[model samples]
Target: MIVGGAIFQLCWVVRDIAVAQQAFTEQYGVADWFSIPDVHFGTESAELRGVPTDYTISVALGYAGGQQLELIEPRDGVSLYSEQLERIGPGLHHAAWVPDDYDAALTEACAAGIEIVARGRFDDIGMEFAYLDGGSIGSYIELMRLSEEMKAMFDHLIPAGFTNPWQ
Candidate 1:
């Protein structure tokens, strides 16, 4: 249990965000989808396998009960999301945990020989995340660190622009 936190989010990588959102909404009954479009991770903001890389993606976040559901569509450049979509098509990609002690959890995971496949930060939102190779597990595991401001924003995410279709 390297992550060692309650899983709060589930993410799927898709070819088309709008199609994925509609299917998820209809099938899972997610209340609303909050779109975060054209998220750019500059070379300074992200890394792939410890090498700085630039990429773009669009994400839609929704809620079903306490769990947050996410749909990610790669827009440009190379990333784990795009690679997974190419290798496996579309389906569950990762489960995420926000540990109470983010740094400690990350340190421990690294100390335990877990491979960090990707990592990035949204500086404007004071948030960072890492994707860990799950090894024997089929899907990757994500660890997220969110600032208080980011947490507050996430609390009201659904209401900010509810039902925002992909763009």
Candidate 2:
């Protein structure tokens, strides 16, 4: 049986990662947790079933109220986020959740009628993700699971605002 996890992070899709990061820093007084350049994988080209085509993705991480915030920018062609940005102008993209049995959970979600919008594996992070159609929810949803190595990496590189006062 697949054990579901809580919402891990909320993603904000933007056109400019630097501007977005700076805005967040200035507005919320939060520093960037980490920023990664465009990372490519698998085929050089692909298509989103119901969404637009995209090539590369650039991501930045930040924190607010004890929750991680992911910022994504599509570098290649049009993408799901491109449409989202056109409609809403760079804001919340999706809420992410982690599941113990990612495959099983995906299967169950499909069985229950949630459509898979997009999916890919982040080789550097040792994690895979799937975006689900939200229907009436007005937002996409992400399902993700991390490998042990990735978990170790996260533990080693703590985000800036995570200092423990007692320590």
Candidate 3:
């Protein structure tokens, strides 16, 4: 899972991770940016376009005002994030959600015809997440599983500014 808080992060697809992180910090005064480079979804289990493909992406997380902002840079492969970046350039990619029941949420989403575009797991932290096509709501809704470590990290993501995230 990428984030653990109730108010999930807003993701932006960017071409450069360092540039985006710097922009967020300089333009919005968002600090404590936690970054991960080269996150790969393993083959066989994780499918991209219905086939096991090697997809890698880099991410930076920081709190702006009271909201969480994530900047994602697609590295190598063909995931939905990469596709969005290629089709529309860098912009708002998705809004994430951490549900109470992973399987139940997925089942409910499927029942509503909210298809799972991409799902992956990172065994290193027992973390897994899925990107659900927002059926009627529009865009993509990312559902992430909550890990203990992630929960701990998310606890620090509080209201950073006296005003709002955009400030």
Candidate 4:
């Protein structure tokens, strides 16, 4: 299995994003949350276990150290967040890895028994991401194919004077 990239994001499914983001900011000192609401996965473009669905969710992102802490709240529909919250309560959902070689990283994750659970394209950013269910570990792993546009956007969020991650 390919194993060079490091985990970049820690995602959680929360019952109330507004409250959760506040809690995280206060408790962990992870401030400056960038809120993104009504994330739309087109009717035919998004899928869960191969079944298409027009699921939407709200998300708030904050950087803790060098890793992103994402808090997600399920909207008025059935979605990955909804299912996870129903079965496991509001807690850690997935950890994302931004790999240089997206295809090879996916192949390695799959070879290690991480099965694709949900996938969709973010048309606005021209990037695609997939969530793999890390079966035995009982958590999910998201593999994001970082496009140039996505990189540029995230780079802007770098903390303080450490704008360069490579430094």
Candidate 5:
């Protein structure tokens, strides 16, 4: 296993987050999405292919069984999300994990020959993340480390019955 555990989230890139959310709710039984309509990943906060890049996206997050489901609508700027949406119009984009040791886990992935396509820190939320190339799998692998505050926020947003194991 790359991160040595179960995947916590699966994300899909889409043209419209609202439509995608409805489709997922109806087709895959995922309901109760917590949406953030405008998220700005500025050049100061993000990178693409090791170079500073900016992007904006709207996302709806929910749960499907035990895993978190994310639907992203690329709004502006060049990013992995936008690129994937262009290359393979609106579908599965990545599988993700929130490992306990972020740096160590990242180093291990790099040592294993997984290329780091992008990495950045969301200082406002005390979170850091990276996207690793999933060449053979035809998707990216996301590794994230969240702060206690962010975990608490997620816990609050999740429906009463759902769980966030990482939190």
Candidate 6:
């Protein structure tokens, strides 16, 4: 399995994306990166084996130093994020890592005893991601692999922002 990209970002699912964003700005001094609508898929679209489901949601992205923070809020039915929010009340939903070989990484994670919680694409970003069992790691882990077109889009869009953390 592929390794070594490092923790790329952290996500938090909240009841209200705007409220969470404000809280983050006040608590961590992070700035808003962007916000987008998203969808989740599963047996029932939002059902979790051990938690509740969080379906169609809105996410706000923010940046601090070299890491990103995502605030997710349900826009429709139940979803994984909604489940987390129900249990924990809007905080530290997951951590993300970038991998070159996503399939191989998933294989490795499974071999290492991590469950594949969900897998899907972010159409807006042209990227795909997988969420592994949080119970195993004490928190959820997300692995992202961006397509070439997505990388190009990010390269162009990110520079337009007020802060370029990677630089």
TM-score of each: 0.91, 0.81, 0.84, 0.90, 0.93, 0.77
Instruction: Give model 4's clash tally.
Output: 0
- Which portions of model 1 miss their true places by more than 4 Å? 158-167
Task: Name the lDDT of candidate 5.
Answer: 0.87
Each candidate: how many clashes? Answer: 0, 0, 1, 0, 0, 8
Which of 1 and 2 is ahead in lDDT? 1
Alpha carbon lDDT of each predicted model = 0.86, 0.73, 0.77, 0.81, 0.87, 0.69
The residue pairs found clashing in candidate 6 are 46-53, 53-78, 53-79, 54-78, 54-79, 54-80, 55-78, 55-79
Q: Judged by TM-score, which candidate is best?
A: 5
Question: lDDT per residue, candidate 6, 15-58, as tens digits?
Answer: 87777778788998875558776645544322355454546778
Model 6 poorest 10 in a row by lDDT: 158-167
- lDDT per residue as tens, model 1, 63-92: 876667899999999999999988989989
lDDT of 4: 0.81
For candidate 1, the 10 contiguous residues with the lowest summed lDDT are 158-167
lDDT of 5 by residue, 16-119 (tens): 89889899899989868999998899889999989999999998999886678899899999999999878878899898888888889888988999999988
What is candidate 6's local distance difference test score? 0.69
What shift in Å separates residue 93 of candidate 1 from its native position after superposition? 0.9
> Which sections of candidate 3 miss by over 4 Å?
1-6, 157-167
Q: Against the true structure, whose lDDT is highest?
A: 5
In model 6, how many backbone clashes occur?
A: 8
How well does candidate 1 score on lDDT at residue 124? 85
Error of 3 at 156 (Å): 3.9
Stretches of candidate 2 off by over 4 Å are 1-4, 41-47, 50-54, 157-167
